[model samples]
Target: MSTAAHSLSSNPWKQGAKDALPLLGGYIPVAVSFGLFSVQAGFGVLETILVSAFIYAGASQFLFVAMVVSGAPVWLVIVMTLLINSRHLVYGPNIAPYLQKDVRWLPLMHLLTDQIFALTLTRMPHMTPSDRLRWYVSAGVIAWLSWILGTALGAIAGDELIERWPLISEVLPFALPALFLVMVLPRCTDRRWTITMVMATTTAMLLKLFGFPNIAIPAAAICGALAYYAIQVRPTDKEERS
Candidate 1:
């Protein structure tokens, strides 16, 4: 790459770790909530940590535990996790071009989640390829560690916290969904994105009402992606009017 790119690439791992610090503000609470809920759903501390470690998809893990507690079958939980995480398919291609070709990518794939995905999208294009990888890996590692620690804390005290303040029991589960809304709302100022968001939410709700709750997320994702892609590929109304 160019000299400029080389300079920017320097200290990428450190910079990436530093940049990821802000994300902890959101990650810690949600992860701890997830841990507490996991215990409430009958998971032990070790089990909760393992889910955070291996699954690592925050919202999906939450949904998985919920489904399990509701007596949903194992197949249903697995399928829902797959459907919920399908969004990562979209996240992957966006960053693939900037990544180096290596085995390290395998582990990185496991680290991929909504927060890091969004973080990389904004920051990776500015980084050199080497720095991009360093930043990506380092940021992911920090998020991962923080999540585990938060989960441990939650598992330890989640029961007591919920017992003392019953409202917290109700509110903790919405943490990730609230975070999702915060992310989506900013982008909704664009008409096309507004339409896409409405379509996705409507599709999910309609599916759930129709007794397809388990498949609602994946179906809505497919519909929303197609709707947005169609809008993007089409000439704008101004172009057509012209």
Candidate 2:
């Protein structure tokens, strides 16, 4: 291999970017949908773009636009958005141990998204500790840029495009969720993860049925974590008793 090719392959940042390439297919369409929806809900193109650039939370941004369009108060919007995104509280610590201790994490934490977290979780085990941060940052930047680009496109010309091809709108919303499933499903091969997945899914479904849809996702996540802990501890407790 050429020296330059070998160098690129060895660089954590480049490897991260390469890993993140598949995420574009997901991030772009969903971000475009967000931008288009925000504009249609009466936001300016710049405003829509800023939402993607700054807020950067996927589904929460859509929820924010919807709530604002419905004339919800500012405090409520902030609270609801935070609630929807509270899952990140779990995401951060789970990935933190894999990162180098000396690396500054506060600024980089903002780039943590569901997709990026999942990507890193699965791949970081294979990476050296020092490479983790660089790889994550590179992947995050790529995902972030794709989202912004998609938002800009949708904000600027989404209406015209949708009018020209109505079917695109229907399909865009599914892209991100599909991407997430593809990343997560492989991990379910582990029995603990499979049980956790089942528990989480059941909890979410039960909550939705009980008329508590807004809290379902976070609650499911909490339950799943607890369930996994219980499963993990049972083996230890049996060993102690023996």
Candidate 3:
């Protein structure tokens, strides 16, 4: 343990890793698939690993690759990417309480992602500042490592595995949705979040087949906002003739 961790401050990095391990176990297949697709799409091993490691955004990165293949304009891709990742802004405040002021904003910013954000938010309400940072960093690092390794392996051996297993062929492409379900369903507590999730699904389906808008990030934000609104509108029964 670092000397710094033993103080009143909880070690954010270590705890983050602990929470992140279980989640990373499930992320393996999806990460590899992404790596496979990225390579097939012409991204080299270095590019694939770097993006997974640094960008840390699977949906946006995948979409970026697809757009590149389609020969979309660079500006359009950039705009779309930003639009898709806009949800990050919301992650800051929700996690702010748990974060240590020890680091500047940039380092903290690096750790934001759907999985980490969701995990941190759930535990943030109860955490001391120290534990929050440690947990988030640890979780983020684990996610980062798994993603890099998974993609590297996927890109290298994607074809062989796909050819060998026919079931993967049949059950293919479900990981993203499955992951989404796992991450989002747990956070649903009110009608708004429910509606938001439904809308995002519908929108994603509608646009994905045709073109234009990307649905993943937008859908997440939509659901998140609606959930927030619904929870806020939570009604309380009035006192009777006090």
Candidate 4:
């Protein structure tokens, strides 16, 4: 094996696409939905593709499309997008130890997004830092490509597709979250982490009921991290020493 090849996790763009291939196959419906919805909302192929490629954050992208479709104001759409993808901050620190081997913190955090962070941290812990970074860049950037292509296609071709396919609208919105679910389910071995996650999600639902859905996710995640540290970290640390 080439020392470089053996050193890194894998080529980032390639690894990302490879890992996401199965999920991407499933995501085509979701991508197509974005395309159709964007066109319906006055977005052309260019606008649709820009949102997918640049924003590259799934929940935000879908939420933006939903807002545009509802005839909402542009500012409201922006706020919603920011709120939906705010979890990237939390994802950054969790992966710091692994990436510390090569790059500094800012650059490491630069490429991170919610899904990419989760995918890499859970799956790439044992790989070379180069390979780990490669894997992350892989999924992040390629899924990004898939998103833009699908949206552009839908924007240009959505109405015709709906007239023909009919079922895609119901399914596309679920794609990114489904990919997240797949990533989340596999790495849930830490009981404390699992507890924190469930508690966070439950809290978000309750907060939403109280008329503050926009702030729920970050608030819940913060509270979960606090609760986990308070309840479990000390014991786990002590156990590790023995």
Task: Give all candidate RMSDs, comma-separated.
Answer: 4.1, 4.4, 4.8, 4.3
Give per-model TM-scores: 0.78, 0.88, 0.79, 0.76
Clashing pairs in 2: none
User: Runs in model 4 with CA error above 4 Å?
Assistant: 1-16, 65-80, 100-111, 207-213, 216-220, 234-241
What is the RMSD, in Å, between candidate 1 and the native fold over all Cα?
4.1
Q: Backbone clashes per model, in order?
A: 0, 0, 11, 13
* Model 4 vs. true fold: TM: 0.76
Candidate 1 has its poorest 10 consecutive residues by lDDT at 175-184
Q: Please estimate how well model 4 matches the true structure, expressed as its whole-model Cα lDDT.
A: 0.68
Poorest lDDT segment (10 consecutive residues) of candidate 2: 1-10
Quantify all predictions' global Cα lDDT against the true fold. Answer: 0.80, 0.87, 0.71, 0.68
Q: Give me candidate 3's TM-score against the actual structure.
A: 0.79
* Model 3 lDDT per residue over 5-102, tens place: 44323655656666787666556777778888999999898888888887777778888889988999999998888888877766666667666667
lDDT of 4 by residue, 73-166 (tens): 9998888877766666566667767764564445545446556666676567656665666676666656566666777777887888778877
Write the residue-wise lDDT of candidate 1 on 103-190 in tens digits: 8898778887777776776677778666777788889899889888889878998778777888876776566556666655676767
TM-score-wise, the better of 1 and 4 is 1
- Give the Cα-based TM-score of candidate 1 against the true structure: 0.78
